[model samples]
Target: MAGRKKTFHGVSVGILMVKTGFRRLPGDVGHAGTWDFPVQYRVVEGATPDKMMALESSGLLDEFKAAALDLVAGGVDGIATTCGFLALYQRELTAACGVPVASSSLLQVPLAHRLIAPDKRVGILTFSRESLHASHLEAVGVAADTPVEGMPADSVFVTAIKSGDTVPRFEAMRAEVLQAAERLLGSHPDVGAIVSECANMTPFSADIAERFGIPVFDGVSLINWFQAGLRPRRYPQA
Candidate 1:
């Protein structure tokens, strides 16, 4: 038999990172060590967290689409983004880059709902409720009226990430996220699962799941799944 031709693809997933100076802890999407597979990263210039939270990320679609194309050109098998708010640009990015684009964790909402009982629905914990518009949810196939809770505007997580500050106190950020999760559960008692809409919130996903005894999904988990499709597992022959 002829030898298989060698391929030089370096990574399976390419991340479209937001242009921010905030500290990304180990589990955060922006942190390279968060993934088990080699992944590429390209920051979308001017796509700041604050601007995105304010629904201004639409202005940076061209920049993100261009970055996705760059990653595709570099041989990445799939693409994802660091901010869930980018759900608004998923279709455009997928069309432009000609690759599977998992632009936001919000994409898990529909699947989460399907995984749970009919009476129980998926709830979202995000960085900004006011900023998580119906358009963003609808674009990602989430219900327009889905229950959502947001981190406190004055939270350490919000302040640090939004301002691009490099000092995010992990403990405080976790506490704030827990508060948001609790609030989400309190207000939406039928929520059987949680989906965090801020990619940085992935660091506390396990904590949220343990505390609430419910499934928690986030950008990191979604990205990992997406990468698996890009490079599916192969079993060794016996």
Candidate 2:
């Protein structure tokens, strides 16, 4: 790649993955669009951040930090963590990686807010209200009071992510998400967009858009845009 002329973007992206099971791979995000930039990823030790924190409840994470630096070593211009819940470690993880790191798609909050009108606001879709913290919004540059709604299940998309040969209870899951989204928009009435807080929820974006008639953002889309900005195309030779 070094010897090749800059026929495309000279920059690349890196991802530090949470230790979710095989069901949570990131193939879906890449399909949203051509990344143009090279991508490198590595998994840390944990089934998921939800379970990882539950397992240890510790504030320090030395192992995940090492994993983050390893991916950056591949020449990626920036980095993003795989799970939104990892926002708890945003400052620490970003500091450890020594690069631009997205601790969460929640960052969309501030960006989306700017895109939205003053009268129309932005909303979020995640696992549960209890899981979110003021720092999560602050990390993303949105107010913690910003409207956020999601599945009643404590596990949220993680359930579907971990779905098996049984195909998951998507029908029921879809109903719940749809209801939550609809209720949120209906109640807020002035929401300009909805951000899917879970990466696994990308497949349902079209449905959300069609049902709600508003812009719907998901982690896959968020990461794609974030990665693009950090490693934009420099296809001078294209």
Candidate 3:
């Protein structure tokens, strides 16, 4: 009746996290309060924000693969990561672990493109424009010329997040995010949707949408959607 013996576990998703001590707000993928389903997390010891944002993430591939494998061993049906830049490692991670891997919110770009008209494209709001290279986008099947906007390097959000502050200036961060969103939209008038590439920006997604009147997608929505497919709702038969 079955292939290899498989076990059922409570958790539906295993989140591979970067090694950082930052305070995760309610909307962050790393924050437990962000999910409606049971989930597990494993931090790749040396995969800090700096390392993750680096131009090349291949060096940390083995570390991330090991952590993801451990999560699979723990019985998680699917795996995800807390950073969008990990999009570059998507192929390797998925290959190393025999499970569905949703490594980056940027993966939503191609889907978002279908939701809007061809003339209107999806815009990306990332933590660092310089770091979100063509390889990252290409790895996830997104176009290299996709519109992208990055948080100001000196902004409060970037400063707090990179510093790993347990108690970040939320208001300051919100302002910074809103400002970034505005700048992105202003520069790219043809953008029909905004995709937040930073996992921590999920908390502000609602506000961004409300203010801009456009759908805003992030890691939270991506992973939640991915998990819903893995563990679908059971309805009563009519």
By TM-score, the best candidate is 3
Q: How many backbone clashes does candidate 1 have?
A: 0
lDDT of 2: 0.66
Model 1: worst 10 consecutive residues (lDDT sum): 1-10
lDDT of 2 by residue, 17-131 (tens): 6655434333344232434445666677644555643423644367677777766665666777666776767787778876788767787777777887888889888766667
User: Using lDDT as the measure, what is the rank order of every candidate, best first?
Assistant: 3, 1, 2
Task: Rank all candidate structures by their TM-score, best first, as comma-separated numbers.
Answer: 3, 1, 2
TM-scores vs. true structure, each candidate: 0.94, 0.78, 0.95
User: For model 1, which pairs clash?
Assistant: none
Candidate 3 residue lDDT tens string, 1-238: 1142335467879999888887888889999988898889898988888888883834899888899888887788889989999999899988999989999999999999999988999999999998899999999999998899998889878888889888967788888899999999999999999999999899999999999999999999999899989898999998
Question: How many backbone clashes does every candidate have?
Answer: 0, 0, 0
TM-score of 2: 0.78
Give the top-scoring candidate (lDDT): 3
Instruction: Write down the TM-score for model 1.
Output: 0.94
The C-alpha RMSD in Å for every predicted model, in order, reads: 2.8, 4.5, 1.8
Q: Which stretches of candidate 2 lie over 4 Å from their true place?
A: 1-11, 22-38, 47-49, 52-56, 154-158, 162-173, 235-238
